[model samples]
Target chain A: MAESKWTPKEPMVSAKDVHKSFGDLEVLKGVSMDVMKGDCVCVIGPSGSGKSTYIRCINALNPIDSGSIEVEGQEVNDPHLDKLELRKKVGMVFQQYNLFPHKTALENIMMAPMRVLKEPKDEVETRARELIKKVRLEGKEDSFPGELSGGQQQRVAIARSLAMRPDVMLFDEVTAALDPETVKEVLVTIRDLAEEGMTCILVTHEMGFAREVANHIYFTDRGVIVEHGPPKTFFTKAKDPRTKEFLSQIL
Target chain B: MSARTLIPGITARATTDLPVLKPFKGKPYGHDEIGFSRFLANLSPWAVVCVVMLLALWPMAAMAQAKYTIGDAFDALWKWVPFLVTKGFALNILISVTTMAIGTAAGVLLGLWQISPHPAIQKTAWAVTQAFRNSPWLVLLFIVMLAFPFEITIAGVTIPIPDWMKAVFGLSLPIMANISEVVRGAIQSVPTGQWEASESLAFSRNQTLWRIILPQCFKRMIPPWMNWYAILTMATPLVSLLGVEEIVTLSRQAMEGENNHPELLIPFYGFCLVIFFAYCYPIARWTISLERKFSVKL
Candidate 1:
């Protein structure tokens, strides 16, 4: 609870005693984690685990029923850091791709930059096109989400998030909806992102991806994190029995 | 479980020709107890009965048709369609378009409101939508006309907004009612994951509603909305009560000879049919195309 004098650069995102409940159901029970400036954290857990809710709290997507979340050194519980600001800093991609179906891939990338960010047209267009190229979706800029395959749409989603030049990116099972063979294309895009040091927190079942891309990996169970450590130690020899059980089940 | 639809390249792969195709190969029509065969067998008598009913209803249909003549209807349509480009048919068009625009905007807002996180907003929206949906549109028109005769004022021109205005207002309220529910239903129909994703992006409630929710709802809306427009067009005659000098009113004048002679009824309405169909056919076809396009997307 003590604030350090130097502030420690206010880890890109920090949550403390974050509790969120919907009706009588408790989704996250006092979750707290610190994500450094450019660290990649992969969250692994079973279906009902709070991985998704935890990240959403950081962006103020799903309000933390009772908790404090901070992004870029500012407290999120206040009315000041509205969704638009948090979203600008913490962009997210969905497991189902969630690309706007009616918009072209280029427009999807350009919209937030133009509308929410209020960036000028030419600059946004250029940056959006560059983002499309980053995700290996250069030629498919004008194509709608429905026109693209599942993997392509997911990549487009990734491009859309990246278009805003966010300080952090959130991925909720980015490739889970993709065909088996198409999964690698999306993972490859994320890998390229991780290599460039874009701060990322991923909720994924892909153990190989976690082991490869994440600097730190956290395994959660029943709304609580059972293990947290560097990927090698956590994936190979987590101290908790739950993590081992999960690894076994997933493997 | 056993009966299959004979649809080939879709439900059936083998049954190419209908004549030799066995009945069991067809798809299930409905009802678990009675498969397509039994259902068809049961429907045979109904079909015969309906044919007889259709024969019986022919006279009524003929009588309805006899109310309007083509010549009188044409005279009515020609007089109105071109006469008052700003005040007559065009005014109806403007009024309908304006009413629909306002109603659609309000309805969409109401629809989104019905799903708001706040209990008060949602409940209030639900009640309003239900009331609008339940209240007769004609009653609404009459009520607006009657209720506003003393209240609404404009630039010191207190010309008690006529029944025509009431008709437009009344009709629009119901349209707004239906549109709001339609908007809400369509928004609800979308996957919950959309809200989750929008939340993750941290779009405000308004942004999420406009960007994520409403655009997705448009596909679901196209069909019902088009149907509403077509039905609204049919109900345009109802506006004549407000004395809007609409097409039907023109038809009545032409039919009655405006010479004070009570003319025959058949030619009177017959003229109406041609005018209505001529205007409505293209819109109906457009709606059909839009429905097909959206259906494919869904």
Candidate 2:
């Protein structure tokens, strides 16, 4: 609350006293956090705990009822904020790979850059191919989402977000829908992104994966950060009983 | 599921006379007899039905010698075909095409308005679509015919409103309503996830609607759009009641030109039916195929 003790550099994403509700049901209850530059923050919690809702609120995908969310000094919670400009910096991939079914894998990655950013065609196409290869989908550039396997589609979705050259990336249980064998490929892609210093926030059930790739872990429960620490400390020596209980059940 | 053998060699090992393979051989018994039975098996059901219908109508064909000879009917057709094409048919097409263009443009706006976040816009769109959609097409046609000004003066110049233009305006109301429903249904059919993904990409509401949402809706909207067009085309004859010189009116005039010949009455009306069928049947087939091809999997 005083300052983000975690970061020496400026925070890329900061949420302060965020409160959100759907009708009478309040989802994010005074939730706050700081994701510094290059931080891979993994959010883990039970299903209805508002983990996904919190990350969505960061980019104004879901508006906060009260509080402030700032990304790169831009007030995301401001009503008059240029949301399109804000969103260009914060790329998100969904649990179900929401790849545009109408576009090919390359076009899916290329469209936002070309249309939204008004980037040059050749430049966008070249970058899209690079992102495709980064996500380990080199030859699948021309395949439709329906033609690809679940993992391949998810990887393409990741590449699509990366194509925007976003300052921060959000993954909402991206590999949750994949088969067990296919999960590794998607995780590997995310790990590669993290390794290359792309700031990421992941809401995941994969504790082992979170432990492996995440720099910091935020244990959320009932719309609050119940526990937060480095993954090694958080997974091994979580001080809160709720965090321990959640970890015990999951691990 | 049974584990079917994938290898052709394995299938061949089971039997020498494989039915699936037998179709490929030109001479099954080492004889060059491509029989009539095999030829008949290859024919489509539609082709067969046409042949059978001609066979059944042979007696009727022979009976046409009585009052109006086939030659006389052909003569009537020869005289009327060019007249219908040059005058009445062109108007029918103009009416259909103009109504379609205006209806579709307004319908898309109305449909998008139905989903507008603003409550007043939504309510107005709902009322407009429901009002037109619920009314009888003929009643609406009559109402437009009577309600619109017969002539208008813009500045000092007076422009007369043609009866055909009135019919087009009337037809467009119902067409617009139906198209609004089609557009609304198509947009609603898209999964919620698409909206979330597009929104997260920071696309403005207009960008999301026009670029992301509308493109996806095209596949769902097209079949019904074609279906509505065919129905609209067929209903163009209803304009004759408003005294528009469409096909039916032309047919009546052509009949009267021959002294209202009772003998030629069947042929003249039947000619209208054939023309309508010729235009509509292909559209019906095309709409069905489009429905099959672009049936939304999501």
Candidate 3:
């Protein structure tokens, strides 16, 4: 039994009639979705399904052609301010773990906060150390990205994202590139963030994570969200037949 | 009879005379001629090294009298070391730095200009860089000094401005080509993902550059930059032809003129060679160290 709760009633971020096209490929077609405050949405779909593309557009990584997105009470089309201010509040973690190769793990985490956020050194060091420890990258602060394993690098990337003190963290298949042994550690970190009530929109194939950690689940296909609901109801009994077919392949 | 008719007879004679020829082996596999050719080719590179070394060093060895021991050579060299360290070395270093600075700034601009969306700008920059690259450095120097103003003009101004500026232009002419190619390749080498990532951070096309593109481009670009610097250091001697009172000219004038005369021209040109070595070697070493440093981690 589906709840009769209307979606737009408690939206924190909203995209209305969004559209984007890359060359001749119309990736996002009038797609509109809203996320409530502190919501953990896991977007699951096949490759080229545009779930990753949608999450990227949430941060304006890809500008929409025709629609408007409002984030944290700011309209998408409004200009005149530096957007680093907006970006500081929205952090993104990449699939390939794009840590600065030149910097140590500690410096990688500390750099943005010190340079961008203008945090003092003592506080930066303290926070960076704590975050590194949280990601189980303890005692490896001085190591460069090349020195670390793939799992460790991804964890450092997560810590690097968290250092910005973001209001929302976008994880685009954050563990997809890691070995099976390493993926569990990164998943644990995301799970910890979810349990702590941090807002996260994750695009992942880890159905277990989508089941366990997602407060809300959105199933997208060919750039449109076909259905979305709480994890227990949606993953267990999705309303859309496409969503059912996707789950059948994965589960 | 010829051996053709007497083959069996000769064989029978040899076999009758020698017991070893009685039992022949099954087959022979490898050739000594191939092995000899391989052996010669292996030594060819080392032979080349020795020839070049003797060619370069034999002149000094001949000019070097018994009085000219390594110690005397060192003393003659060392006597001018400070004069070089201050004036001659400084001039050589200054030339390299200035050309490199001009070349890099101009190269980056021209590289972007060459790739500009505007066809006229891109074509112009490409044509100019190609001309700079193809023009021989010494020949270009002579032409720019002697014939350019007479042959070429732009807008309302004549081409040749002044002698000193001519020298600077000549030195930097080829450098523009080198730098244009370097920076163009470097910027292209960076993946589109880097630009996309910066844009994702809400940096505008321009903001993305300062925050991301140039930093990565320049850092990865250090090797070519250092190589240009070294070549520029060695090229300081070319300014002698431009009548720039640079080190090579100063040393040459010191040797030819009567004043401050040594026993022979050896002290003058010999001292100059030492100066070239002293000034250029450390910087070359520093450039190598820089390469090692930059390549170490990232």
Candidate 4:
């Protein structure tokens, strides 16, 4: 394969020694990682392992205590940073989907582009319809989030994020809430996006999907990265005992 | 054949005396034995009103010393009906509508302030809400009526602040506070994920609140808002204490104009009750239906 000879481009998203705490509990302890453009990095870990926290920091959702996170050369941790601009570039899909309950699926996809980006209505509608098709939610455009199934809602959420035309996508356990049967559908949608060369960081528990779709896999334990490598080496020959124990339990 | 003969262990006296198990009669133990009382118990609201009017006026009609009978009092009420409705009840509705408008507008802002990120703004909003919410509506009305000037001159232009207007401002204070709570509750009831989701989408706080948060809250707020309007309309009669000339005050004046007969009290007050009930009952029912309709499944 040409994978071995391929060189990484400049990092599109970089986090250095990120530290964050919630009151007395520290969630991320000096965590750091980098993603080149179009790199699919899957972060896998047990519950409360800071995998979600680290990715959330990239989009400025959870403010870090003592670290620097930059996206596209913009300082995310800076107090004066334009968070709106930062978030526009970094789209995030949460576990619960969180699509607006009042709006239909189409309106949910159209909202951010029209309201935040102030895009033309007709143009946004056209693109939004295309996103709906991309997420395989074509006929469900008029359905509200409450009316759709969990997997379908998650896909619509993905489409909603894509409406803003973000440079990078963050998936924080997007499939964790789905039924076992529906998990595959969502995973397939996400895998297609990753294969299409979207710069993506996924904090997930689906180890098999992570192994199959991600180029690099990061294993975090106790608020820090225990081990990380390309999917083949990382999954088969993990060096750290902690990573081995976690992989053994989940797999 | 006696039960004693049919069964092996039976006593003929006990079996025969066991009040022949007749077909199930009305209520057990003769609780509703009187047909008239049963009819009274089952009366609808309008039926009850009719029965009450008859019972109350029957004695007055039979009073030997009474010069003006119940019929005369009702005739006087009929004479004053047009005036009471147009001038008095209209003002009540007007005050309620105006107060609701002002209260809702101010309350929404106050409610948003309660959830503001700044501690100072949030605390101040909370303090104001608690203060007004805990205060008596009547006391607030009195304070507003007594404290505000009837008219004020601004840059040599005189603007008259009428008494009813003051009443509206007074009534709106408590309504504002309560509506503020409604708004705050509705906004908070929306899952936090919504805020995070909007934030992740790069929506500004104002944009998220106006476009996303408020639209959802609007539906939830309606039932309670209509509830407050009903309560406020009922309380509009309180303004009559300060002589704002609403239905109650007008009814009293109509009685005085009709020689102030003692018999006039029931018919006049009953008219007020019927009109207010007629107006507010539908709103209360509608509020309940709306509450059911807008209830979020989640």
Off by over 4 Å in 3: A1-10, A77-82, B1-98, B105-165, B187-219, B233-296
| Clashing pairs in model 3, backbone N/Cα/C closer than 3 A | none
> Residue B144 in model 3: shift from native, Å?
4.8
DockQ (Cα-based) per candidate?
Answer: 0.46, 0.50, 0.18, 0.58
Error in Å for residue A36 of model 1: 2.4
Off by over 4 Å in 2: A1-8, B1-86, B254-270, B296-298
> What is residue B111's positional error in candidate 4, in angstroms?
1.7
Model 4's CAPRI class is medium
Overall local distance difference test of candidate 2:
0.83
Residue ranges of candidate 4 with Cα displaced over 4 Å: A1-8, B1-44, B47-65, B296-298
lDDT, residue A116, model 2: 90
Interface RMSD of 4: 1.0
Cα deviation of A73 in candidate 4 (Å)? 2.2
Interface CA root-mean-square deviation for model 3: 2.9
True contacts preserved, each candidate?
Answer: 0.64, 0.67, 0.24, 0.87
Interface RMSD of each: 2.1, 1.2, 2.9, 1.0
